[model samples]
Target: MHVYSRRKRKAGVSDRGARVGKIERTTYALGWRIHTVATQGGLPLTYRVRQANVNDEIPTLKLLIEAVRLLHRAGLSIKLLIADAQYYWKDFFKLSRWLGIKPVIPARPQIKKTLINLRVKHGFIVEGDPELIRQYHRG
Candidate 1:
């Protein structure tokens, strides 16, 4: 399962669960953020609703843990996990690796630069195998 965010804007203060927060630079809204975990085919596996101020990563780990547990109980296994760069924190990668899920996320800019530099310092080819490089670049 993978998580994605949806912005739900409220029209009035009577919208009990929504909160006011910046959605983007210089823009603010009263809303709830819907974080959902879904199958690769687009079926929702589970979801969480939180005030708009909540960051995606905060609930993502919890959502993944729950999804993994549910899948395990059904005798299923997750092969790969695909998520946006927002979910590219090192701890998340480590946890997914520990759980045997191949993460298919593109590194954030700073991390990408660090990885490139590390590869160069280690004398490893930056784009060694054409096909493998292609797949990595796909994310």
Candidate 2:
């Protein structure tokens, strides 16, 4: 699940239950955050909507599990998962590994640096080849 925001700029909008949240410094919006799970082909599989103030990670595990179950029933296998930095957490990584899915998310900057340093100290490859990394990012 990845989170995306939509602006609700109209005043006195009714019944949509949009909430006001700060999206950046000196900017605020009334809207919802969309959590979407999509295929590598850019086809949307499932989605959930929640208030903008809600955290993206909250629904991620549940969404992944749901997608896995649905795919399994249809005889499909989940081979790789590509997501943005917002989904880069240790638990998320563990979950994907446990499910036999290769997670292709770039870690947050500090985490990335730490990981690279550790890899160098342990004599492991710091990063994949540029072409392979680029392909994953494109997805």
Candidate 3:
């Protein structure tokens, strides 16, 4: 499981003339971090664990590469990778492509914005673009 971050409001003493107290903002962080890869049958083949302070993308990429190597040695090759947005990045996608593995990852908020811009530039709806749709769906 992955940890999610959320913003919270805290009560604080009022500083201005208003009767309502100031709202202090607080953010919560996940306590543990873990990345895993498994076979299509749901048999875990790789595991990477780190502290909460570690970023998810880097370790996940490393773990994937290692899994690929292990599978290759065992006369097996992966065809697809499924991951969350936290582990999604351009480099990861490129690496997966180079290794002949299709990656299925959700676009980050910024990536979604970029896609919107691309759609406008081409003057075509995303649904009408076969290649774009394939990439978006398969990637």
Candidate 4:
């Protein structure tokens, strides 16, 4: 997210959460990071805005937990969860499985070759591409 520094601040105020992060190789901007857990139709279930430099896993875990709890109260369970390769944390995925969610996170190239073809919904699944997953798990 790009934030235009348009507003003037108070005399003794500090830029608390505002931060600078690289937008591109040669470009940079001061802005916050937005983390959201939403449905397939793009309806946001939970969200958080934090400093750009903050680790995504922190708020991501919080958002997922919040969403899951809400859904559980409504008697619904998440069957499939699609996330970025950057979210491939062992402990995180373990917690997701304990909650009975099927997480589909792409394996990074560096670890793809080392990963086994486990079909467990609790652990990492190597096939992230929809086409590849479909090809292997034919219906």
RMSD of each: 6.8, 6.0, 10.3, 6.5
Candidate with best TM-score = 2
lDDT of 1: 0.66
- Give each model a TM-score: 0.69, 0.73, 0.59, 0.70
- Estimate, for each residue in 5-105, the C-alpha lDDT of model 4 and write its tens digit: 32246564546567776655487666777788887667888888887667777888888889999888999877767665577777677878888877666
Put the candidates in lDDT order, highest first.
Answer: 2, 4, 1, 3
C-alpha root-mean-square deviation, candidate 1 = 6.8
What lDDT score belongs to each candidate, Candidate 1 first? Answer: 0.66, 0.68, 0.60, 0.66
Residue 81 lDDT (model 4): 74
For lDDT, candidate 2 versus 3, the one ahead is 2
For candidate 4, which ten residues in a row score worst on lDDT? 114-123
Question: Candidate 3 lDDT, tens digit per residue, 1-139?
Answer: 5443332347543322222211222533534455788876678899875555565676877888899999999999998776544555678878889899877655554454432222322332344245545555443
Ranking by TM-score: 2, 4, 1, 3
TM-score of 3: 0.59
TM-score of 4: 0.70
lDDT of 2 by residue, 1-139 (tens): 2234454367644445677755664876767767778888878777788887777778888888888888899999789887765587788878888889887775554564432112211332335456546645578
Clashes of each: 0, 0, 0, 0
Full-model lDDT, candidate 3: 0.60
lDDT of 4 at 83: 67
